[model samples]
Target: MNHAWIDGRPGSEPEAVAAAAALIGGSRLPVVTGLATDIAGIRAALGLARIAGAVIDHQASAAIYPAVTAIRDSGMMIGAPAEIRRRADRVLIVGDAFATSPDLPDFLFRHEPDLGKATRGKREIRWLGGPESSADIPGAIEPVVCPADGIADALAMIRAAAAGHRFGEGPIAGEQAEAVAAWMKEAGFGCAIFAVAGMDELAIEMLAGLVFDLNAETRFTSLPLFGPGQAFGAALAATWTTGFPLRVGFGRGFADHDPDLHEAGQLIASGEADLAIHVSGLAGAASPEPEWSGRLPVIAIGGGAASWANPPKIRFDAAMAGRDHDGVLHNERFGSFVPFAATQTGTLPRAADLLAAIAAALGDVTTGAAA
Candidate 1:
């Protein structure tokens, strides 16, 4: 299963790796992105980025930015899923809570209550936006139909009410706001949940602020829902390895992080990167390559070959982490690394193996040039 391609034509893996290595090694600036792999694969990609003096980012970083930025600006009181299921008697969800994770209802109703140690009373569920669904959520007293676009204003009103501050009317009525504020204050443990995929930065910030404010009087935490992708794992790997998160560059003989300037989309669109390496090893169809990616040569490695409109210079069908190969991935629910055993013994090479090969070839090119 050494299926590889170069310039839209069938080629050997060695040839493809050699061509990709040459393209990356000769470039003054290279960018590595499409980081949908597990921790092992991301670590290999980061190593290559460091050696190639490239900038690194993830395809889903844009969707993740709001929550990450919110956490960075105002520290978040994060909670685990298990803890929320066991302890959170009240859950305040904003914007289509079940849209991203369909199994959320199951977790909330069937799974959470089955916990033998969870002696808490029935949980209360509330929603802010999104169309109503037929799925029966336990203890759903009433659904608040707040506009999706007006979540920030709604959260601000809630925060102000929680803090006992006088603010003019906004989305939610003053009485409703006061009631919600009082519920949060009285709840033994409350969890504020929001899906970042559908949320704006201001909304996330407002939610975080509300949690922070509520913690003043009672125990409250946030459960920011992220879509199914190992983007969190990628970010965590980058942070632990480089002392910085994604959108980091290593061109100046050291890792430098710039969330705005060095973002993969901006760098590629601005013609700052001469070459790009797109890596994705997780399951599911890959997203289309950025439009600006056509400005430079691209080497793609992963399962997302179907998503690319324009063929890359070199492409390799790599094994999916945790499915075709063993790897470690961050479990956000429990905030731990879960060891995933290989489910299939496929011939497809692991992403780490492919990237390591490219890195070796790149090193040879560098060494030869220096000699």
Candidate 2:
């Protein structure tokens, strides 16, 4: 069966791989993005980037960067999901965290923390800027409805209240501030849960500050939700191989990282990148923006290409990790890389194989490091 296409027509895998190689070899600057794949697939894509002198970035970089930047700029007290679930008596959901992580509500509220009979009191769940409905969420939850952008302001006020020094007026004021402050002071173990998507760096930093303030009086930590793409897996692979996260370039024959300069979207839009190789193997993954492919030659690989409204110049259908093929992935719930078995055997080509083939076609040997 033909799994490769040239201009949307069925073609041999070798021909498609060669065509992709020619485009990458011929371009002055190429970019590899949409890194929504397993560890092996991501490593293979990174290898191709190194040989082709390309920039590497993930599709969810915009969403993932806030937490990364916050952690980098100001240190954070982070806790794993298991720890949060087992110990936290108070959970503060910042923003609409449940939007991206649907399992969070159940994971947190299905049962009380199993610390012991002494600390097995009802878990108090509060939402800083969460959804209105508590129908889906188990047990009683307090939703602090406020403007989406005002999350930072609310967090600042909460922090000031908890610290016993009022920091001027803001969205959360007076009694509400004092009440949340009292709540924080009373909690033995608390966690601030937030999603990076739709959250700015300032908000995350402010949330981190709140966690720190709570830590001064009690045990508290922050947990940022990650998802949609296997972004964590991608970052892990890229960092292990290149000693840098996404938004790295191999133009200087060595890995260099600059968040703004090497951004895949900006590079593609500004025409700095002459070619794009998008690799995504997740099932039901969205296609690259039309503007991206419209601006430059694109070679899209993996099951995600099926969603492209306008087919890229070259496309290859590949196996979806954890579904079509057995693969290892970063399981957020466990907070570690875990092996997943395929539910059913699939005939689709594996993304790692396809990427390795393209790298080989470039006439450069590629090597992968254990991730």
Candidate 3:
């Protein structure tokens, strides 16, 4: 198969798709096609979802519907970082606790403590430990004794406290859980931010089953500090344009979305997305399939001459995300916007911008929210 590769930079989805489509017509990775909304990386992945019979997955998975359902079914609360930094005295960071970078504790105590904002005052800070005690809280500060494993017990206790009740069983029950519950009840204003950790293993639907249960009784909110650069931006853009996130299929001449039924990974893995219109930047997350189905045809559009055994021959070229054009990225520490500084390593294509070009090439690819 002659592969037509498109350089899928961070902001060039439309261009990448159009380029690949001009050659191969459609793709098979339904999940990759699903990101074709107005945002996420370059955001047109949603447009190609059904055409390729691929599942449109967010960087995580295609089951973003459950996340939406969770939000709608169980109302949530929110406080921006600006608010948390200026006003939140006690910050609770939990889930998949890994490395305790030096700057984290420093940010809570040193920087956030003295914000210039007058209305939102600052106060004492505490680091709620994750499974691993990565954050080096000083001896003086008491790290919330997050059990090595029993997060559910702690969560149930918190739930009980939030609901004006108490459960005496479980590891986090009794005094400890009560103490957290009391804190929740008393805090003038508090924020709880959730990430992919709570249930990255399960689909967003199943994950929501647990999360909604938490939101049922609490004033706390859950926000995914996302993975993949511009991930939130992508989700926001996609939903705005199409009313949904990843796993939009565009194969049947229009768009169709279903998280469980159409994940790109599953599609390609299952040999469904026979012709892959892959738009990737070196930095962003791509599918981690151990091998591409032997029959799969990949029109890989990107900015590298990288080779892989899975596809045997992947047509590729140079592309840009943070390079070539000034782009937008959020810092790792906090989701602070960082302006990209483009260097004229001036290689090949910009993935998102390329996708925009592809849209133009394909001509009149509708938003097709109705489809």
TM-score of each: 0.92, 0.91, 0.71
Report RMSD (Å) for each prediction in the order shown.
2.3, 3.7, 6.6
True lDDT of residue 275, candidate 2: 87
Candidate 2 residue-wise lDDT, 102-189, digit = tens: 8877876787777732175878988887877768888788878778988888888887888888577777656787788789777778
Cand. 2 Cα-lDDT: 0.82
Question: In model 2, how large is the Cα lDDT of residue 89?
Answer: 87
Among the numbered candidates, top TM-score falls to 1
Candidate 2 Cα errors over 4 Å, as ranges:
116-120, 288-290, 304-309, 365-371
lDDT of 1 by residue, 132-198 (tens): 7635565555566677787888888888888899988787788888888888777678888878888
Which candidate has the top score in lDDT? Answer: 2
Q: Where does the lowest 10-residue lDDT sum fall in candidate 1?
A: 110-119
Per-residue CA lDDT of model 3 for 1-371, tens digit only, reads: 22243332332434444555454443323335323212334454544443333445554443234444445455345455555555554445545432323344454445444433323544433334354454454323445666535555566666666566746776553776667656654444445544543433333333233334444444333334444434455555555666765455655655565656656566667665665555555343443432443456555445333445454233444345555556665554565555676665664555555555554554433333225
Ranking by TM-score: 1, 2, 3
lDDT at 298 for candidate 1? 86
